[model samples]
Target chain A: MGGADIERLIALLARLPGLGPRSARRAALALLRQPQTRMLPLAQAMEQAARTVRTCSTCGNLDTHDPCGICTDSARDRGLVCVVETVGDLWALERAGVHRGVYQVLGGTLSALSGTGPDDLNLAPLLARLEEGGVREVILALGATVEGAATAHWLQDRLAGFDVPVSRVGQGVPMGGGALDVLDDGTLAAALTARKIYS
Target chain B: MGGADIERLIALLARLPGLGPRSARRAALALLRQPQTRMLPLAQAMEQAARTVRTCSTCGNLDTHDPCGICTDSARDRGLVCVVETVGDLWALERAGVHRGVYQVLGGTLSALSGTGPDDLNLAPLLARLEEGGVREVILALGATVEGAATAHWLQDRLAGFDVPVSRVGQGVPMGGGALDVLDDGTLAAALTARKIYS
Candidate 1:
């Protein structure tokens, strides 16, 4: 039905995170249908990104520059650093427009089953940043999962020697959550435990 | 959080059939993570397909060659031509491996609401192929929709001038479909109407 090139394109597209074989084929066909407008531009963009995009040495964020924009930005508070498990999490925080400080991407969390230890993450650079001083506070914004808790605990133990204060993001009912009846047991418990007093 | 190239890649990817902005960003990040293994090869494949693929003049199928591999293949029966609405349909039939005949891709069906007409389809090459003679059968393997029926009727009216016999693919219960209770009214009607003779 198709030539080798088209077959290869479909196969490669199938390797992406959400795309499977059928969807990849559909995407390939959609791209092929408009070669000049869609396929060429996408190919050029991918090529350009592949050639230029690199990981930031300071914060483990991905950008074309070594230090990344957030690391080099003077306006953002360097004294307050938010530690996230992945770049995706950092992007999520940035999208929310709440964080006015820099980020340290751990790349991944520690997992016993996956054999991911503290060394597997970007902890060395984070420690180096802490050792350089001037950082006033460190915020652990990791997930609510067991691996996230384990990673945060390990980081807390390591950062105890430093002069900077460490804190974890508050856990409770989310901003747009529904009624307590619809909430899960863990979330309900967290919300009850972390309840604030009325004025 | 990303540069122009990465943003451009995400935007372009978001235009694909099943992907949205968030998924596209995930895909872009996945690609960027392994530039050597995933991104470069996909880019190269897209470029190659874009540069080499062309529409087959004879059958309207996409291939690197002029007439396409199916049209030029001596093993397939040239006397039986399966007319399909798109190259994707042709690929589907080919994947089934039930058809020993060649194909004629109509590119799209006739639609009054969308302003698609006979002139907009690949009817010229089809008529030309019929006029060249030796065509025993013309099978309409279009979708089971109003547009497909309209297109089939139009083709039947046009092929009235030709000597070849025109037929449509059967409409009935699918291969792996469940009981009659689960089937929709249209499909049930189709199945009952097209019921075969019991041995």
Candidate 2:
């Protein structure tokens, strides 16, 4: 029955940022029933991704290689490093197009509540790389939450001995932002709470 | 530069459901920065799908063969046919696990407002299949709206002379359903306006 295949796909898709079982089912059905041209690319992409995707050994970014494309790109500014909590955060920063430096994906932010620490993150390797690679500056692009700031402070302290400039991406709404697509439930809730209703 | 490839991907992704330029850009950047697994699979899938996926000659459903798996399944009950407005609808019905017969996807519903008529849909071929094949019943699983009703009526009148049964799927809240996922603006607005509060 199509149920098994659908269930499997839905479970996999549910793990994606904005999707749940219902949405996953909707997406899977769309792929299954629509023109093959419209959906085959996505399926193939998913299939290939499942097979090959792994964490970058260098920057902790999701990649097929140990060192990601950014790490491997010779033209990129290796001296400048942009530090981010996760791959998602790194992607957001990249889309902004302001950063020309290579990234250091921490894999996760420091969180006492979640029991995440320096050892758990890929920061030591980043520090080792920094010592070897003449990195001049490190930019921290973290969330505005207390935990994010705490992590930033921790990171600054950890790199205190090193002679490198550390900066943080400014907090506020994304500058000159266009309409956001696919506002997932959490973002939607945040937006709703932020909204000022007309009289 | 990776910019052009990122832009091309963003354009394509922007057209997908729930993706704007920002999200598309983010997704594209994610792929670009970590291309080894992501890009390779996506490219492979795109190429393979383009080569292999085709429409079922009998039904409009996407398939590698002329007749889709449902149409060709020997164990399926061909005597009864469930007619749906879209292949997506057919998949929805299938997920509910209520229907046992095969399906006939209309591709779209009849809409006088939108100027969609017999020619615009795959209705003619459906009718032909009904007449030529040993089909005894047709179940209408279209939305319970004006266009859905009109289409159902049109089909009923067209096949009035034939000795067969025509029925509609149940309306109102679905079983195991709460707050339908990522509904269109119109449907979501309507649902919000029509929602009932329980004490």
Q: What is candidate 2's lDDT per residue for A146-174, written digit by digit as tens?
A: 67888899999988778788887654334
Worst 10 residues of 2 chain B by lDDT: B1-10
Question: Which candidate leads in TM-score?
Answer: 1
Each candidate structure's count of clashing pairs? 0, 0
Model 2 clashes, total count: 0
Kept native contacts, fraction for each prediction: 0.69, 0.05
Q: Please, what are the lDDT tens digits per residue for candidate 2 over residues B75-119?
A: 888888888887667667666777887887788888978999878
Model 2 pairs in collision: none
Off by over 4 Å in 2: A1-15, A25-82, A87-107, A111-139, A145-147, A163-199, B22-53, B172-199
Question: Relative to the unseen true structure, what is the C-alpha lDDT of residue A163 in candidate 2, on a scale of 0 to 100?
Answer: 79
Q: Model 1: which residue pairs collide? A: none
Query: Each model's DockQ?
Result: 0.78, 0.14
| Predicted candidate 1, C-alpha RMSD | 1.6
In candidate 1, position B64 carries an lDDT of: 85
Residues A124-193, candidate 1, lDDT per residue (tens digit)?
8878888898889999999988899899999999899997899999988888787778888887888899
Which tens-of-lDDT digit does each residue in B88-193 have in candidate 1? 9998899889889988899999999999988889988778888989889999999988899899999999898997899999998888887778878887898889
